[model samples]
Target: MAEGRLQRELNRRNPFETPEQEAVLNLLRTGDLILNRFGRLFGEHNITDSQYNVLKILRDEGQPMPSLGIAGRMVQVVPAITGLIDRLEAKELVVRRRCVQDRRVVYVEITPLGTKLLAELDQPVLALHKQMVGKLSQPEVKQLSRLLEKAREVFSQ
Candidate 1:
């Protein structure tokens, strides 16, 4: 039957035409899977991955930063940062203040509540990082990270 022939052909020929294409597809698929897992983990604590990223960035800076500065640090657009800040502010995780000297500029600062939540998330976040790439040896992880960094360099142009 035609079905049998199709099955035979499929079995004879590999699904991917080239190793490079297969590797790229595999990398994208794996990244999606890992991100999904991380999303669920973060959602359990009432935050999305992006929200956590914003909080962590603010924490690391150790001081309030201009809204544009935060947007620059993030991959998101400038306008979207306003909505994101609104949501975080609504949740009492962060507060926004207008710069006294420059009324046009707004600064975002993480609240104490945000700091407490981040501290709570620390253990689980570290565990998730370990679990995601734990199978790889340290050298392998370092090499993989280096390769990925190099791959990103192409986009900077």
Candidate 2:
């Protein structure tokens, strides 16, 4: 049957690869699937994942932050932050204020409208998290979180 043939092809692998390589490939594949699901959820709210992240960071800081500061917190380049802020400003979700003391510095702040939007998203966001990993017991969740943090420690060097 076609299904059987397809399964056989999928299971086929290079004989030269070691177990570590296969494990890493599997991890990448799983991460992609998880991120894709979150992307679709964020898209339904008329904002990309990156835009949501920017709004969240502003909310967390509870004050306008310099453009460079936001970029530094994120893994994005300084130039890309300008365009991102531009789009958010155009949406009226955020506003930009130039530093009076230093004209070269710009601060970005989330608007009241942005806060309301994020509030509305709160329930759905929690629901999505529950859908993703709610089945795990509390201990399992803690263990998984620890493992993920440890994995990131590898790159801290």
Candidate 3:
């Protein structure tokens, strides 16, 4: 049998038990490698991937967002959002305010500094994305996105 790239990379002595397992492992390995690249980029700017994500979400919303709302959109658990917010707040990247009507509720708004940081990162991030998948043609990229969206739908249901 011909050696697959992943098999050679892993230096596996035996073949995968099944194609399904092999595909899943390949997807995970690819994601981890890509994430590591992004991690280094984010590190240079003194923020983790999660922090960048939070700031980006707030920027996209165009208004102050509730803590729970931000938490809902994060990959991390809800409890983790608090610590993430605290760090961003300490850096003056975000400001937290109590809700006017519901004091129990906290709203977070990105600072101009945060917006500036994201703006600076925009080009590098785009370049990184292109670098990661530049080998794939436009059509293949679109198809891959469609396939990923379909795969995610299973979890939504």
- Say which candidate scores most in lDDT: 3
Better model by TM-score: candidate 1 vs candidate 3: 3
Which candidate ranks first by TM-score, i.e. highest? Answer: 3
Show model 3 residue runs off by greater than 4 Å.
none
**Model 2: per-residue Cα lDDT over 1-157, one tens digit each:** 1323323445764341555665466567667777788899888878887898899899999999999999988989999999999989999999999999999999899999999989988898888877777779989989988977887898999
Which stretches of candidate 1 lie above 4 Å from their native place? 1-14
lDDT of each: 0.88, 0.84, 0.94
Model 1: pairs clashing at backbone N, Cα or C within 3 Å: none
Model 3, CA-based lDDT: 0.94
Prediction 1 global C-alpha lDDT: 0.88
Candidate order, TM-score descending: 3, 1, 2
Give the CA lDDT, 0 to 100, for residue 36 in model 1: 95
**Model 3: pairs clashing at backbone N, Cα or C within 3 Å:** none
Alpha-carbon RMSD of each model: 5.4, 4.2, 1.2
Residues 73-98 of candidate 1 have per-residue lDDT tens digits of 99898898888889999999999999
What are the clash counts of all predictions, listed in order?
Answer: 0, 0, 0
CA-RMSD of model 2: 4.2
